[model samples]
Target: MKADPQAQRRLLDLQAIDTALAQLAHRRRTLPEHAELDTLARELSALEDERVRAQVAVDDLDRDIARLERDIDQVRARKDKDQDRLTAGSGPARELEALQHELASLTRRQTELEDAELELMEQRETAQAALDQVTGRIDSTRQRRAEVEQTRERTLAEIASEEQFKTSARAPLANDLPADLVALYDKIRENSGGLAAALLRAGRCGGCRLELSATERGRIKAADPAEVVRCEDCRRIMVRTAESGL
Candidate 1:
């Protein structure tokens, strides 16, 4: 392919811009915040599960404590009623003796119920502590996630702005070039990892960093100024300058 000598030189500028754009895209994809968010998401999910389990345990203990309190209250009420009847002394001796025995039994039952209630209250306290700890961890994880997301958004915005600038600069330069030359560059770039041209400096193929053999140098030296030369090794356009040592 043939392109004006100056137009070919401009290809280098276009390549630099394109390379910068590619680097920006890579940075965007591999931002540290992205990985951090993923890790935090997993941690938050696990913490949420733990919080659910803790809350369920706390709720179950609450129900048990409430039930025990009701039982203790009923037992105390029965004991009170029995004491009141005995104090009245309105029944026969046999009946009064039975009432006294029944009051003793009711007292024992009340004590047992109160003891059980106390144990349940302790368990509820422990369960509540566990739930609080889990909830605290959840809040912390969510806060971290929000911070990371903010950082990620800021980084993306910066990348996008830089990309826009590079893109704007590239359009006019690319548009001014010969259509065939730009088409060729695009094709090579697509296949060569975004590198379509390189300077031939110090008798070396800049794209591959390989020295040109004597015969290859001689051929390129004989070629016309407007001729597009591709490196034998890397197949990229070799843009020659005074420093090329051709």
Candidate 2:
């Protein structure tokens, strides 16, 4: 397409800006902070689940201890009443003998309750330890999460500022170029992984880094200024200048 050389050069500048912007966007997406945040989030979730389970275990042990205490109390009270009856002379020998036997059974029952209480205490302590560990992990994860968030925000802001600068820099070229040409440039940029225009620098194509033959350079120089020329190596639109050393 016929376009002023200056306008074409401006287009190249716009292309370069857009290419840099794309790289910035890709970097932002692949930032380590993003992965770090994800890892922190997963760790936090697992810690929360573990904490909850530990708390539940502690609660269950508490209930079990309470129930065992109540049982022991009831059994001891019954044994005390039986002993009182036997000592008060209010029962026959057989009845007193039965009361003593009941008291011995109550003692065994109390021992069992005590053992259960001990086990429950141990379980409670273990649960508490697990809870503490999980809480510590949660705190650490939260701190890391905050750090990741801050880093992500900062990086995003920098990228935004850079993109804004590139957008403003491309503004001057937008008015002079036709919409169809701009679309074509954008398509080529997408297909070329963000490089749409390349400078013919030092007799070489900047995009492909391949030297242009003398005959090819002569033909490129002889072409009309309005004519757009492509590099033989990469097929990218080539913008020539004195720096090209053709």
Q: Go through the candidates in order and give the clash count of each.
A: 0, 0
- Stretches of candidate 1 off by over 4 Å are none
Query: How many clashing residue pairs are found in candidate 2?
Result: 0
lDDT, candidate 2, 1-246, per-residue tens: 766778778777787778788888899889999888888888888889988998898888889889998998998889888878978978688888888888888889889888989988998898889889888889988988998899899999999999888888777777668776677677877888788888889989988889999999999888998787888777788887778786
TM-score of each: 0.96, 0.88
On lDDT, the candidate that comes out on top is: 1
What is the alpha-carbon lDDT for the whole of candidate 2? 0.84
Give candidate 1's root-mean-square deviation (CA, Å).
Answer: 1.3
Screening candidate 1 with a backbone cut-off below 3 angstroms (N, C-alpha, C), the clashing residue pairs are: none
Q: Tell me how candidate 1 scores on lDDT.
A: 0.93
